[model samples]
Target: MMTTQGGLQPTSNEANMCTNDNGSQLGTRIVDEIMAGKNVFFDLPDKLTGEIWTLKFHCIGAQPGKEIVTVNIDKAYVAFYNVVYIKSKLGYSGRDFLFYKKRCGIDRSRLLALDYIHQEEAMLSDNMDERKISFVLTKDPPSDLEVSITPIKRPRQRTNVDEETIEVSIDAYKEWLAILQHDNPETDLMDDFREDTIKTYKEWLRHQGDLPDILLYERMKNKPEDVDIVEWHYMVLYFGSEKFQKISSRNSENRQKQRTKHIMGYRTFSQISFQQRDPETGIEPTDLSLWMITHCKNDEWSEEASRGIYENAAEKIAEKIYQTEKFYLTREEENAIFQTTFKETTGCKANRLHGHGYLSRYPTRSQVMESKFLEQARATVATNQKNIELESQVQLLNEKLACEVAERERILQEKMQALQEEEEKKDKCLEKK
Candidate 1:
């Protein structure tokens, strides 16, 4: 039977004698603590000629335990049965390594051991060790170590070419509204404003930030996380050109009752952590941080999880007007919003949402597999049906063949009988003569 921890064990007395002979300072306890904790790095050899030793202690059969109290200096790793292992097991103190080390009588702390569980905090104090490592401890050790490694780069297949997708969740969407409110407390897309007539949209739009945030924010507010930012922007701008603003008298009171409930929309720059840009092609894969705009999903304007996609083109339109002419609301606002890049040709070649490519549905592996299985099943049924049809045709042909053969034999028998009758008549006539 192979042993654990590189497979060689030494008795506690033998281990102590060997350590004495080698003049090694740090004992088994210190090394075990380091191994178990979240230290960034540690070295085996100090001024003390210290080498780590590990073994399975007090195990029943093949099971390993936390009871390795004795360590051998000569053997780097210990075998299970080879060395009569120690009966005494050490349990962790709820405290970290530094605290535990302080409680210990040994002043060989630089050469000492501590609890491995306190690694994240311990690494701060144990900075002298040259070799650095990231300590990852779990409630249960994972079956595969590769589970922790994330690919530094994603494959090219998931590119977001049209520049529409911005990663924002529903919370992020609400935050954008909060931001718009932050920029101008009076300007709101869904929020019941104090008389935000189209007449006042120009005034509202001018106070806002530039094109990128406005367009990106509008699409993000919709439940669908993936959106074509450009298309949404153009759609928003198009609607802004039209004048009548939505006015709900009851909604105003309800809005007041809601009471600017979630006003914290502006996220700090540091909070924008989860984004990636491909080094080779400079293409950004779509980040669906926003809730997805589902095909046939029900979403509320004020609900937390998946909110409704209100037509906020009016919001986009006013912003476009602000970008073009800061304070003026004009009929030209309609014509001007489309003129930006997407509409180079004369007559609005693209329909509503010209620049966007909202996927009808997001494809998943399971969905694709289901479709393929269904297709194969249908093909199998068709083949079985065709075989049954051919079998029936063959049976009919066999019956027709048998009937033809029987009819031919019957005709031959009749002809033979007639011949016999003729011969008999001739014989009778001759006898008369």
Candidate 2:
């Protein structure tokens, strides 16, 4: 395989063969070798098709221009190949590959550096004489070229001949959490263990309310196979706790209070903001405009309940912008103005109204409509206050329930003790008779 500007280009000889033959095994081995700082050279046959490919990492050192460029380009090449191989195994292609790369910590900067190194190597190879160009092989290679390739391990299949154990790091735990929580369907690439763990957690959550304390405690104690015991304990304890329940309930309520929801699925706020750029000015939409555009239906504010509040906030923002002689505000200034306007209009912080708070900074309209908007805003504030009070009451009830449960357990223990004493007294009477 030759490295090209676009990416790895397969030679004519290897064109017919699939890159994913025994990919899991090869990827695992490559990752292990790279982490261990060992030179990897292997000729392995594709498990499915019996096509053979040579995987070698050459640590080449050359003085390109004024600087000494020491890099294992072959290592990067192999790692890149493994990334492709893993992606193929997971059925990820096109734009989804970019997400996978980011998830694996392979950023554009690293890729650019790799490409630059490759370019330098090409220039040196072409300019210098074949005999004079010293090919110095070193055991220690540049750490930058080492990409962290997480091979997707399949269930019921051995990763290696020795069945070497793969340790799940804290980073993996975070990645799993992100993958599970992310709303995108494309991000649902989880190995068997991760999938199982998530399913287990969901099942536990579903029954958390109905299950007794003893049953719930037992479920927490019963750790899944191949799961990190410590992490499992933490996950069960934290997520099952009353504190997390309260937070989740509050977030759900906040989401319910939102007047406008965007139809743009899987696209992030940054992506939407970038896409909302003006064609002529090339300037991105203001935070308020962006929020309004996303939330609006048919390019018009649709929700009658909150429409007045949005219109009033927008007018206030425009007034502030017009007051400035420069007729321009820095992004920070714009954001601050939006937040202040929202607070002044809504009688609550932007964060309190909008769950994430970013959308709360901007309103969509240009003109202030009616005093009725202020009335609506006041009503909204009152509703939010009531919700808070209700949440507090719920928390108190939960605490009271917990105390009652504990008291019941103590009473049950006392009753059991009394029964044991009565049994002992009956046995003494029988012996005396």
lDDT, residue 349, candidate 2: 46
lDDT of 1 by residue, 1-433 (tens): 1123522234465445434432122235434433443122233332333533332222222113321223443232221111212211121112212111111111222122323333434533342232221222122323433222222343468676877877745355446556676887765465346454432443334443344456546654663435444466566555444331233455566566541122214542113212332343332222221122221134433343222122233345557657774665542344334333223322334344322232123346897687557656766777788899899999988999989999989998999999999999999999999
Choose the strongest candidate by lDDT: 2
lDDT of 1 at 176: 52
What's every prediction's RMSD, in angstroms? 23.3, 34.1
Instruction: Flag regions of model 1 displaced more than 4 Å.
Output: 1-136, 139-199, 207-215, 221-413, 429-433
True lDDT of residue 253, candidate 1: 64
lDDT for position 289 in model 2: 74
Residue-level error in angstroms, candidate 2, position 233: 5.6
